[model samples]
Target: MVKERNKSFIFYFFVALTFMMTSLFPSSGYAAESNILDLEAKSAILVDAKTGLILYEKDAETALPTASMTKMMSEYLVLEAINNGKISWDQETGISEYVYKISQNRSLSNVPLRSDYQYNVKELYESMAIYSANGSTIALAELIAGSETNFVKMMNEKAAELGLENYKFVNSTGLNNQDLYGNHPDGTGAEEENLMSAKDTAKLAFHLLNDYPEVLDTASIPKSVFRDGTDDRTEMPNWNWMLPTLSFAYEGVDGLKTGTTDLAGYCFTGTAEKNGVRLITVVMKTNNYQERFGNTKKLLDYGFSNYEMQEIVPEGFQVKEQETLPVVKGKDKEVEIESTNAISILMKRGEKELYQPVVTIDEKLLTTEGALTAPVEKGTKVGTLTIEYTGENTLKFLTEKGDDLIKSDVVTTSNIEKSNWFVLFMQAIGGFFADIWTNAADGIKGLF
Candidate 1:
């Protein structure tokens, strides 16, 4: 009876323990805590520029019209051409009928390019970015790739190269057309043309700011005016309002693109840096200017107020010191390994030093059997060195660390192929006499 009572007590204890464990874990539908947005934007994303961490996102991947923000990619390609020497900043482009007709329409932004007039690439790019001029965009596109049709092909290819799978480009200028739109009267283009997502726009912005920071020279400008090189100075006003309206604008909020269309509403891709932390926020498809500015400001305020950029890995931070890794059946017995780079982790201020960093390396990658041959480069990526921490997500790439591995030539000292009969005989006789002489000396020392 006592044994039965003990077993029943154990069963009750286990039941209580199970209840505690279940209660300790969060529910399956528990959401990550985030600030709620006031204005309704179809899509939005906030990302850490340094670490590429998505801090907050709402419908970021949903495809929508990007409006004049498409020119961001256009601007990137044009800048690349200038950098590559395929075109020059001062290179002149003939004003075509396409450019002339667009200038006559007030609805379109133009620099008043006459049919006989020639405008330099610099004026065209400035006009396109500052005023969102459709004429300059088309003229610049034609000059770069010989025609806008061919330029669109390059745009698609470049988008593919940048891993923007969900994006498609129909025209350099994101002008809406009814024929292109399906039966939906919402004015948004069909899914097949002139569409992109907030995430991809952020990705493009990241690459542009990182790869070609000079593009901001045009995007951040308050206003610009240019003549069509025919004596008539046409004034083009910048549509980006953030430069004029905000007094406490973050210092690094210099060079990002803004866009708007009847169908896609208004969109802004803005970046700001405070202290050392840089953040990029994308607000898309807002109803009006106030909504765009308010939503973007809210996103930026949330980022600057909450998150920070912390250098988890300092400049000299190393996972492993230079050590020899063994090699088998090769010219070398061991190879030298060193840390490839110093990685930085962007997180909140206090959160940086709180988490434990776990270092991991692949054993197979470290091994240098037949995989690694002699004369490996100094900075070749031999193996991945990962630093991780515990958080809302499992572990992310602080940076993709790799081995600064170089091959060794330590096996040459073990050569055993040489054979000489005379030398061997002389060595044997010398060894015997030497052993006898050593024994005699030892015996004399013993007697002493």
Candidate 2:
């Protein structure tokens, strides 16, 4: 009786331990609590361009005027049309009356455009990017989408596809004309301000950089000639003061756009690369043009100083650190698994070491759990690995106290060939006995 009572107690104890383990370390892994940095701008955000991980954000969802920054989307659409073979760099677009009048407005930034001179896609794009020329921007928009109305529709569609939460474009120029709902002076395009949240703006910038990085080719030019070598030639200087050519330029800063409007105040989307790490910082509604640059510099300084991107699980990372798994029918009864893609995590400096890795096997890859069936091909994803940040404590494999930082797919390292009839028979026998033992063990435990 004492022996039976002891067995019951032992079974109950293990069951309790199993529940505790499941509760403490869930199969999905733990999500880490993030600490955000303080920012000064009315709407600002900093994100790791590659990882799409947001490092800092303040009122980033509130929509505000984006001003000439709206040109980014207009630029993206033109590039898309070029890439899809719908248009070429040499395609010409005539300047419309609306484009001409807007360009003539001394209040707005623009290049000297003539209604008689038709500009190529390349020259117009250059003028739009370098000079923030409203006429050049609308010209490109009209050329791509047949009309500014259709072009703005395409812009909003692309925004939706990119998961932008709050973005509304009333005109290609991003001008603030309270007469937006009413008829426009041209009797064609709506005269309203373009609205975008800082976070959405950052997201749009990422989409632009990731998909059409060539846009930077124009954004990075310190100085370039617009409609060069002609009677209408004009020299356009890069408005982005963060370029190294400028006295106040920050290190590694590169191509992006800037904006200033009465309603939006001042805004800038800037990118920089250092030591193989690239960061995207967006500042909206600053006091002035100079202050926008200052806010961007602060965000970039904080990002580069505090965070480091580290490759934790490299692509083809040998699973179990080179450990092999048993196979049911393969000629060799064991096979190896590896990571499918390289996995990196951006963390605060010196904080990466506190993380621990946990592999959640989709199949029972354990030797005792029975071998996986043969015919496993190389790169066959079979499981996932979760990395948990254990906070201040340095955790090796212990993760109960840690936060789940990143997850990566684990795959087969090599192919498992089919087995001969004899090997199959042997595997079948072993599986049968393993199943019997498991069933018996479960039955005994069930009594408790």
Best by lDDT: 2
| TM-score of each predicted structure versus truth | 0.71, 0.79
lDDT of each: 0.66, 0.76
* Model 2's TM-score against the true structure: 0.79
- Winner by TM-score: 2
TM-score of candidate 1 to 2 decimals? 0.71
lDDT tens per residue, model 2, 301-369: 877876788877776666455456677667777777766666677766656566666676775544465
lDDT of 1 by residue, 77-164 (tens): 9989999999999888898786677655656665677888787899889988888887788888889887767888888899888777
Candidate 2 accuracy as lDDT: 0.76
